[model samples]
Target: MCVSCAWGKPAKPHPLEFCENGAKATSWEVTNRRADRAFFAAHTLTELETWPDHDLEEQGRLTHPMRWDAETDKYVPVNWQDAFEEIGRELRAMPPEKVDFYTSGRASLETAYMYQLFARIFGSNHLPDSSNMCHESTSVALPESIGASIGTAILSDFQNCDCIFYLAQNVGTSSPRMLHDLQDAVSRGVKIVTFNPLHEPGLQHFVNPQMPGQMLTGKDTPISSEYYQVKNGGDIAALFGVCKALIEADDALKASGTSKVAGTDAIPDDPSDAGTVAFAAAMAAADKKHVLDHDFIRQHTAGFEEFAAAARKYDWAELERVSGLTRAQMQQAASTYANSNAVLMVYGMGLTQHVMGVQNVHMVVNLALLRGNIGKPGANICAVRGHSNVQGQRTVGITEKPGLVPLDKLATLYQFQPPEWIGHTTVETCKAILQGEARAFVSLGGNFLRAIPETVAMENAWRNLRLTVQIATKLNRSHVIHGEIAYVLPCLGRIEIDEQATGPQAVSVESSVAHFHGSRGRAKPASPELLSEPAIIAGMARATLTKGVVPWDRWVDDYSTIRDAIEQTYPETFKDFNKRMFHPGGIPRPLPARERKWVTRNGKANFITPDRLFPEFSLGAQSDDVLHLATLRSNDQFNTTIYGFSDRYRGVEGTRRVVFVNTADIARLGFSNGEAVDLVTAIDPETERRVSGFTIMAYDLPEGCCCAYYPEANPLFPLDHHDTKAKTPSYKLLPVRLVRSGVAPAH
Candidate 1:
């Protein structure tokens, strides 16, 4: 419901509050097709493996619990008791450290909480999740910059913000509902500036579906005030350019004696505020009077001296060159930001899916800090999330790495000794499995095979596992690639009724804004055999642990018991969980940055300046034909879930195998608009990681930059290519070159 879910909490929700994609997602889940025992009996493993991703899932909900029969090469129905028993036996046989537990954003808060608790109690910390593949950089960077990993602003901030810098974020395609907010902002005179390698149509113009006047008139709302097609892997440089512009503007104002604190003589002789006076004096004495929030920085932040010094080193020419934009364009964007009273910056995977993803976010924080935009009304950083409850999943402990609260706290709360060792992330897990260092893998939900980069490598590695289990609502590519003895356990969809032992139950999910709301299914169960994720988890825990303090039966039947335990475990944040969860709107978790409170190591927000400002853009001593490739999602898709083959918004019809290339690049490479080419990895000559027969279409993109849909182009990326700090794969930035299918080389 976009209307009810909008920033301002309306007293009454609008009758029509959902979006087109929302309807599609619901229909996709509530499909009539059923994957019953007959379905499995009719299809063999080899036959099903060749089906398209959507086609396999369209076969419908998995009706019965099944186990892989290696000899017969088909999945046979198994009772829930036998499935749980065998899984538990295998889990207990292996060293807990050798097994990894994975989760998806689709799981509810209760499921994620119980799943993590089960993993820790079973003596393994290897809890990798879908967050590691997307938005992990947001989690890693924001915590180091601010006190928390989550964004600082609520959705209401959009109403009052004067200007918004949309960096590498396409609100129209990824999250279409967000377009309403952008439209409202535009209508209210809010200036929106966009920076990306492609000029996204959603950011350019959008027609509101709920508004009839414009729909009939065929007029659309203009979204972006200015759009800059920044080169791929140039976000750091573009952000640096903005910071540099502001610094130089302040320097110019100081030289002209037009700044508020231009000289020491202008300062009042208020002895009580000597620090402010001294700051002015120091600025007057320095080569450039740094026009920063001196009082706020001195009182609430650390490392400004180092950050400012590093920022001053980059001049306009260097930044412009690196960012692939002219000096005037950067200056205009900076001027808009500097002139605005309050500015909100929203960014997406375009800025994050890079080798330097962490640094890119740090630069965004640096830009926000330059004008003191954080911790104020209508001013903050908004890292747009991909899925519902991704943030909640992390909050409830679905992390491969945990440092906020110690294991002792969890141990004391749950009355068990939790594992102390760090777990493997999605990238590390792939490597560990490939090297035979890890044996078992259990996934709560997610299409692991398609969601991860280096698809071939991940699939090849996962095939060597002793056991692999998937708890899902629909069949995905992960179900096809399995271990020697694999298991497919069907689970209830989010939109299906869940009749627990206590009563009809409801699960909660957290939105991108950090508000937790109850989501109860309205539709009937797709199949009678489907089990709730929490119930399945409880069954597994009971079968595995000979004895434990936690009551699994009670927790599964009555979800309120799970909430009570959650409240006790996260007392400070989840205080009175049951009372607040049932409120008109669910409770919001504590955000330290919102109140200008820094809970970081030094009790202050840190202005981190990396040793280097830019990441390596070269293909590492490879052929010169390499171009930067950015993997994108179709308009009709959400993450790895494809609703239809047509991307109506992009005018891409009936195909997802097209490569978008800049017109200049196409001509320079002696290729036409509709030429067929083979996309190959430029980094490793030894490996033939090629996607053949991809049609190249001319697009509005920067030179040396191309675009294609992900999972299809994932083969071009090496498994190890990821952010050093975040361990998120560099899906958006890959070194690639196109080889003509039938013609000779142009160079």
Candidate 2:
């Protein structure tokens, strides 16, 4: 495994252990072009729909199992047992709740527990993945705050956290080995902060090519000791202005008192009451024990007096007019988080692609539960998990909105019949194939109609389905946007070499801090006609599961027989799962809020509140010619894999269409330095949604916000918007307007 930078592991191994987009994601999976079957018999679904998704994934890898012949509209080749017997005869002719499935955090946790155990034994708990498009609001707001949606610090608690925060994340173009753990948490003095409305440069200043006097003085280091910008759905009004300035500095250091005093027989409260005796002698010479941990919020949390009466119902001039940030930058970020005793925070997908992303993760867990900051040493909250095994494919049961995987202990350890309703997400599988009630989609690796959000109404509700498939290894553009029968297949990539038939196996992933381990594969395969995402989900669960209690051909030939049925179905989080994944730096699973133990439903640690602390969706309420937008992701791309059209850390270069905005909102929206444009959205007087040329560019954002890039603005989003309790897809805000339309390039 070359890159496990999804939090902690390299205690020692370093021979270019990965980064620079993990060596451009392993040189875009050992590239040397392949697509074969005569490159889909000389490309044609109207010339691979005019290419460009990095030229149809650099026209490489795919190799076989094709299908979509729709009167030879093209994707020819077929085999792999007649594409799993015509996707199991068009998914047993519909109604496994009409087939949805769709994973892709680049598979392999034994192929996402054998693709959610062949979509709940070929029945259907729709099982969506890519964590329902980025941490489904920290998996439904950190299990109602601190119970567990992962991340209670641990990467050696960002090296003793003294204060971190970095909200609405960017970590220098999404996880550049978390800038060597923010350069050892800012060389041990910590403090960071950030917030984000743009101005990102790896949260400003990094360099560290593993230091060596910063490559002989190229210097760098800094990383955000404060930033702020905010405002694109202003993270629950900049985290309720740092929890109303840390509850007004813990009620002004408990109403002013001791100025000097050794055995204080009083006398301090009156130098003519000098500003409440210099705010209680600067909170008694800072010995008030760093403001508020109050014995970890009186022994492991709960709704502190209704989240401190909704944090004294927000004031500081409506938290500086909805977090544009002022009141002395939220009192110097509440005096660097009440003089830090350990903070952490961290966020991303700009606090989960908003519509009040689970009330901006319940106001970032009501300012880390007002100082208890979840569990012990170096406080918590992390979130920054973008893609790499996307939280290990929702820790092995993939999911489609259910609560922490139990399914009656996976139907009594994989016997079957579980599906008790709740499924289809990824915008309810495009509103169940545009309300014709879904019709077979499958996926097992992503690009779900180009990382979702309206992309032409999810490719016209997946072209009114009736079977899609994908399984993927390269060729994207959702394999030439098909349906009414499509296929694709391919597979084996985590650096190739798979083999099967019970011998050289390996697989098992987990990482982004739930740990687990083992990944194995050492190059070679790009094609030996692919196959090995758990043997194409055990050859489509032994040809559409007759459910012979899952041996799926001896767990795709020895993946430790699928880690012994994932320790008999998540036995208290994979206990002894193949001998704790051969130890040496592996087994983390347990969590119980990292041992404070609130596993939710009111066991403890909650404080959620926020029905509205501010930012109840605001882009021009109806239309000041809209704007908001957001979208982003481009340091030469990763999700939706573009790899290069240059972002070169936001100075951009060459191009990826453009936008960025706010040099006084481009001189009050008239626009100039590089114009062109278009965008749109509308959704009324007979619908809209545009997206033309783009350009714009100004910079250093945050004025009714802007930005672009996604699956190129995922077609101005509207697929029934999103986030009513984390259904996700608000794709970082999106309202739109733009217009102009021509003239920019040149010099």
In the order shown, the candidates' Cα RMSDs to the true structure are 5.1, 21.6
Per-candidate TM equals: 0.93, 0.37
**lDDT winner:** 1
lDDT of each residue in 221-261, candidate 1, tens digit only: 99999998888888887887776566655554454464645
Error of 1 at 740 (Å): 1.6
Candidate 1 total steric clashes:
2
Q: Rate the local accuracy (lDDT) of all candidates.
A: 0.80, 0.74
lDDT string for model 2 (1-747, tens) is: 643235556555445545787788788878898878887877677678777788888877888888878776888887898889778877877778888888877676777877886787777888877677777878778887776876766677788788888887776677788788777888888989888888788888888776579888898888888898977876776677667555545544554432221211222222343333343345558776335565566677777656665665666577666667876786677677877877888787777877778778777877887777767777877777766677877877788755567777777776777677788778887887778788888887778778887787667677778788888888888879888888888888877778788667787676676777777788888777788878887887777777637777887778887887777777778887887675766777788887678888768787777777444433434565566888888877777888779887777787788888888877776678688887776443245677888788888877877889888888888866777777788888776778765432111
Q: Candidate 1: which stretches are off by over 4 Å? A: 1-13, 260-291, 617-624, 742-747
Which 10-residue window of candidate 1 scores lowest in summed lDDT? 1-10
Winning candidate number (TM-score): 1
Return the lDDT, model 2, position 61: 80
